[model samples]
Target: MTESKKARSPRKILIFVVAMLLLSGSLRLGSVGIAIASSPEDTEPSTEDGATLECVTDAETQELMALLRERSDRVAEVEATQAQRQKDLVQAEAELLENLNKLEDAETRLAATIQRVDGASSDDVSRLTSVYESMKPKDAALLFEQMNPEFAAGFLAEMSPSAAAGILSGLTAEKAYAISVVLAGRNANAPKI
Candidate 1:
């Protein structure tokens, strides 16, 4: 029984050592196998849609480059449009300012012409009023009869009240009434505001 126990113990120790050596060797071989499998030279030819990995990578790179170029061109075109629009806006602003300046100049000249016309007409009215004042009322009424109704009304408006009254009294009733109506309605168009 002692010899049997001694033989079993040695056998168990040898088997354990052998199993440990086998496990270490297998682990080493597995790591080597993984390394070889991962290497480009030892790896299987991997394909997608019948194209190699390198070819797929190159195609993807080319598509990305084309997309980037298209985007870049679009950006450039947008920038150019913006630049042109800015230039057009500046020109339009300048033209508007120039037109405004021209308008102001025209308005100023028109105002001066109106002032001259007003001054001359008023001077003519004053001279005519004096001429009418110097004449007999009956003679002035004759001239007023020959005058346009609106024109005579304007002369009467500039005259003194007593002179206007004398002229109105001398005029025919129908003519006097029309002139009076024109004077009355002159301020009818005034704005309430």
Candidate 2:
């Protein structure tokens, strides 16, 4: 029993010494790693004296520089694209406003042209009505018979009621009925407004 105790004591002492050495080594490594991780400025490689070669060959340092450069390039590219999009939006807004102004001008001109045509058409109808009123019913009836039913109806409608009645009385019953139908239906589809 005494021999076994002596033997176990030496083994325990050797294990304790080895464990202390390993703990010191691990603590040193941990402090070094912490210093390197804090910031690049803390241990940046420099050769201001031109003779000393700092640890610039470290892969982690090179990878950090590459990542910073890539990020800077991406930011610049995004800013340029944003600027181009703003310019395009401004140009499109200007073009759309110009088109809207041109459309308004065209609409005004069209309205004027329509008013002129309507005035001319009314003047022509007034003149024809006057001519028919001067003629005898029998003569107007002969002329109306040769005219399209729609055309005869339009002329009669433009005249005074008495004159239009005289002209209608002159027409053949079938001709008068057809013209009356056209006149009656002419405004059927007209908008109330």
Candidate 3:
């Protein structure tokens, strides 16, 4: 080969080597890029004036990059978990609120049922009292004798004074006394205030 061809061949080889190194990612070019396959001594950064600067080796940079990637992935995973937890909590809260509303509705319905039952019971008792008041005193006294003293006293207390007195007069002394005692003691333990 001629001298010019020999020289050009070396330049071409150098260019090919640089291109290969760049493609392989072993060599990097930037404002302050480094050769990953270079010696440790060559890893130090320098300026145009040859002033050395602190720098890490390619292996250390790669390790630090790996660690950074790992930390970033962990952070992303944590964020995803937190988001899922938040979503679950919101759903749980909504369910709890719905349950509370259902409970309130049940309570309202229960209150209405109880009030209706109480009103029906009161009406029944009032009608029974009226019927007893219209009966003959001796007839009412006979029925009262077979009733519990407290039960008899409840009916007697609801009657007019004249009707109650007439019924009492017709009852046996023992039954009358027992019913009277129950009526008298009904509010004995009640608060006066």
Candidate 4:
């Protein structure tokens, strides 16, 4: 109504409008904060829209991975040891086979030598005697002792009886007696010349 009252009235209305705006702004801010607090935190990005998400730390996962790595290393070490042992076994088997071959070869040679030596003829005996005559009487006696009794007796029959007697005389009494005994037996255990 009055000029001063009109001016004061306009000021009060402005104050009221400002208060209402501030209250509305505060309510909007409060609602936004409550919505943010109530919402769930983002886990891992979803592979499917409805998929449940779980989270784990890097160090804990890495420790489990390290444990798996250690187990793999142990398995590798055991495999290596087994492989080495298998290789050693193969080597040992090869060595055994090689030794067996060498032994078989040696036995073959020995059998051949024995066959040649034991299967001598009368002419062979004469040649052997001639060779023996050049040797020491003791050595000759040893050869005669080792000879088959029948062959030695036949060879003795072929020799000059005097030479044969001399060689017999030269032998030790024990050997001479053994020869006489063998000669006397009709079933003497000796091979034919």
- How high is each candidate's TM-score? 0.66, 0.64, 0.67, 0.37
| Candidate 1: tens digits of C-alpha lDDT, residues 36-97 | 87788844455777755543678889999999999999999999999999999999999999
> Candidate 4 on 23-140: residue-level lDDT in tens?
9999999999998788777744455777866666899899989999999999999999999999999999999999999999999999988887777654587787677666666666
Q: Report the CA-based lDDT of candidate 4 relative to the real structure.
A: 0.78
Order of the predicted models by TM-score, top scorer first: 3, 1, 2, 4
For model 2 the TM-score comes to 0.64
Off by over 4 Å in 4: 1-58, 121-193
Across 33-95, the per-residue lDDT of candidate 3 in tens digits comes to 544344375566779999988778999999999999999999999999999999999999999
What are the per-residue Cα lDDT tens digits for candidate 2 across 1-193? 6999999999999999999999999999999999778757655464877564556567978898999999999999999999999999999999999999999999999999999999998898899889998999889999998999999989988888898888889989999999999999999999998
Between prediction 2 and prediction 4, the one with superior TM-score is 2
Residue 86 local lDDT, model 2: 100
lDDT of each: 0.90, 0.91, 0.91, 0.78
Candidate 1 segments whose C-alpha is farther than 4 A from its true place: 1-56, 188-193
Alpha-carbon deviation at 43 in model 3, angstroms: 14
lDDT: worst 10-residue window of model 2: 44-53
Off by over 4 Å in 3: 1-54
